[model samples]
Target: MKIISEKCKKCLVCIDACPVKAISKKGEEVTINGDICLECGCCASSCPNNAIEYE
Candidate 1:
């Protein structure tokens, strides 16, 4: 999964939706921890800004 930074609104919605707690935030930036991520698309689905992508 990846975050499309240009589209991200920093809402933290993806962080709350991650089932494995793979998402993290630093300041206004959000990132997914690839090693811990399940790639379940939970965060992607929850993001209102469509910032998270699964590939």
Candidate 2:
């Protein structure tokens, strides 16, 4: 999973949707701790701004 460009609006939609609560905000950006991420793709689907990308 990766964050797209610089379009993240810090909406926190991805953070709330994450079942493991793996998404975290630092400054104006959000990041997912890979170790805690379950690769469930829930965050990607939930992001309204299409900021999260899973591969």
On lDDT, the candidate that comes out on top is 1
In the order shown, the candidates' Cα RMSDs to the true structure are 0.8, 1.1
TM-score, per-candidate, Cα-based: 0.92, 0.89
The number of residue pairs in model 1 that clash at the backbone is 0
The models' CA-based lDDT, in order, is 0.92, 0.88
Q: So what's the TM-score on candidate 1?
A: 0.92
Per residue, candidate 2 scores C-alpha lDDT tens digits across 1-55 of 8877486888898989999999999887799889989999999999999988885
Candidate 1 worst ten-residue window by lDDT:
24-33
Q: What lDDT score is found at residue 16 in candidate 1? A: 90
Ten contiguous residues with the weakest lDDT in model 2: 1-10
Instruction: Flag regions of model 2 displaced more than 4 Å.
Output: none
- What is the per-residue lDDT of model 1 for residues 3-22, given as tens digits with 9 covering 90 to 100? 99999999899989988899
RMSD of 2: 1.1
Residue 32, candidate 2: C-alpha displacement in angstroms: 0.6
